[model samples]
Target chain A: MIITKKSYTFEVSPQSVDFNCQITLSSLTDLLLTAAQYNAEENGFGLRKLNNNGLSWVLLRLALEIDYFPLQYETVYIETWIEGVGRASTTRNFCIRNKEMQIIGYAASTWAMIDHQTRRAQDLFTLDNIGDFASEETVPIDKPIKLSERRGVLTDVFSAKYSHIDINRHVNTMRYVEWISNGFSPEHYSRKSVKRFDVNFMSEILFGEEVKVYKTEEAGDTYLFEILHNDKPSCRARLIFRSEK
Target chain B: MIITKKSYTFEVSPQSVDFNCQITLSSLTDLLLTAAQYNAEENGFGLRKLNNNGLSWVLLRLALEIDYFPLQYETVYIETWIEGVGRASTTRNFCIRNKEMQIIGYAASTWAMIDHQTRRAQDLFTLDNIGDFASEETVPIDKPIKLSERRGVLTDVFSAKYSHIDINRHVNTMRYVEWISNGFSPEHYSRKSVKRFDVNFMSEILFGEEVKVYKTEEAGDTYLFEILHNDKPSCRARLIFRSEK
Candidate 1:
């Protein structure tokens, strides 16, 4: 199936950045959702209204690999496509770009159309009653990063605390990034900088779950590490720091 | 000690709400920071630029009281002040309002000052070089709400799945609201209106945590319930539905 590949572009803004002076994970999630909504609208649905059946789409899972992050005021684009339905879930892909069109990051996610009355997963093909929104580019799930051999220059252990947590039952992805970067004694949080980070969830981290982070130097001045859940891999990623000072 | 009460206002916009149609937790955090920063700057200290010495202010704890959320295109005002300063923390309070000047919500938070080189918490008023940030209202922390008895109208056992969590590593607050609403068998995720809700978090819920919910029908179509953790209160709230769908 050829799913229409739709894309969205946004410029990095100061308000979107964090105290660390970097775009936050929450913002990234918004970016992904915004892009997905764009594709959904192009296919005959948008956020402004419910479907013909009064149902709405909800997120399920997200996986990604980030090579680098665009700095503040740098224009970034997100290209998205539907990857066909698999059993109950539908997959989508996104590519992050800079003003120069460099691919800074890429991601894939899955969502379920839920029935508003039944509170159950609704069949995506019949979701909008418009038949299957044909796609021009039905892609496969993205190849996940090999999380083995995790190493980085800075590794720290953190436990989920009431203050650092969010409304989600899991560690907010952006907060994890913020905490991990903060583990660094570096001075980038307040500076204009560039960053690249990727993390995958393995074991569910709950409130008060203590986890250790392992970091080792990687190629291209990137630091790679794995968030270990009781010595097992919870999430692994490589973060490229523009300035380590 | 009369602490000077400082204030600022921001208009609520659609973009401020996330996919869930709620003013995000981060928006609240940013609002708190804005109020605090204003007071700091008025105290003659540039919170952003500390002469490159790197001493910075960090958030510690925050308690917000939101009785009602403003609708789209509404102008909301936020008034804040440093309630007091302890050895390691400074407490601040935020009062929210609509154009009518009715108190819609309030939040209290603690901030800690840290030396950039040490990355350790420092005494709140120890910096001799620190500028004048003063407040007129020196108050104590608002006593957190405690859960109590309620009537029973609905019962739900919800498992905290991986996707149901956020970075704070617990159930996302808004998602909890969403899910509790989801628990309504007669209504799925299609409620057009949420009249009023008061949720008090008792115990922290984590990833993979399962909650047993009990609801009661209150007077005038309001529903009261408590999310229980091991039979104790994790979150308790009364929801009034205002949307006439």
Candidate 2:
């Protein structure tokens, strides 16, 4: 019998940590994505298989709630599985545990298959027997919500560079996270740690494209961010922090 | 007997690859550093021990020669050991092997211990029993050399940001590699792969510092780079590429 749920362990490297010696949000996200990739590969729907059909999975939305950030050299176990599959998209859930095997975080992500040539979302039902892997599992937190538009203060504007693009020649998800994280000062990170983070990818940003990042403070230690390309929203995110005190 | 020469294996993750699906220079550099950290930790001279004394290891120079770039998901084993120890610094060398156990790359790095508060280099001999760990093994390539001033064309200019700084509140080694790699276009990377890369760090760059990157094309597929902070040379590097054809 095929295993529907899979867990992968990663040790937080020195390069992945920030000044606080805790793993950065982008690195944590990378571990989650890495676990997703490994699970999908084992289940026969991996990127290599999809690429052969001119299709690839694209992350549409993700929401993560963390109780503690893993420190440098700390080991984190991330378990991932498919929650459900829809005609247009699919949901995947993740459970993050510390070295002691205690659950510390949960994440929910939505993804869609897209054609490489057309860059259009493909029908998930076209994939053979993909729905059979759905575990129907659910995380405790709410699903990644649809972030609305907000005319916030412009924090940064720059052209996308080579380092920002990944193998797909599009702005990487981690780059977006890094840009969002850069808006806050180191002092802000020192006193407040991220409690919850939600992001929605609307459109793709290509290399050399001029992009803008805007951030607005919401009530109760919440901040909303929107990244735009040529006046069109490419991605939107929300970050909620908790006081260390 | 203490294990002085150690080998660590790493699988190239999807997030670490470039558009060509091969690991980028920055990612490769990170792996080398990670191996160095592991080896140092095992030998009882790791960052934790150094930090306890208000001192830390700092990279002064590095030179890497690559015969191949490992593709995504490919496992590369890096064997590292201390080559020598001096009063002011130490030399470490790395040999990278592919899945078939074939040597694909070798790297040499020099590091110095610095007092965190004073930001001054301390004598390496002060570390108890550090000399006993030296294996005196050397790679074929020349040691990392000091680069001279070059009036190359300016490639990019930007201020150091939060993500650029590491736990030490200084610019990360990988960031400098990224910046140097960014000077070349995707087309350049597609046609040519790195053969040798050498970098010398003259000064540390902190967050919010305005930095300028300059690139000069040398003879026969070689390039020189200089990064400046406040019109002073902060770092210099050289890259030699092999044509894919």
Best by lDDT: 2
Local distance difference test values of all predictions, in order: 0.57, 0.92
Residue range A1-245, candidate 2, lDDT tens digits: 24489899999999999888899999999999999999998888999899899898999999999998999999999999999999889999999999999999999999999999899999998988889988887999999999999859999888888788887789889999999999897788889999999999999998888899999998999999999988889999999999982
Model 2 spans with C-alpha error above 4 angstroms:
A1-3, B1-3
RMSD of candidate 1 to the true fold?
A: 11.1
DockQ of each: 0.05, 0.80
Candidate 1 residue lDDT tens string, B1-245? 33457667765444454333455444554555566666666665545554255676655445555655565336778887765667787667777788788877777766677676665677766654342344545323353334477737546564554333432334545445644554343232134344444456545566556677777776676677777665666777655565454
- Candidate 1 deviant stretches above 4 angstroms: A1-20, A24-30, A33-83, A95-146, A149-154, A163-168, A179-183, A187-196, A220-222, A230-232, A240-245, B1-27, B35-95, B98-102, B106-245
Error of 1 at A227 (Å): 2.5
Per-residue error (Å), model 1, residue B238:
25
Tens-digit lDDT track of model 1 for A118-194: 65677666645333543435333354344566544434564554333332333545555544554443233333243
How does candidate 2 score on lDDT? 0.92
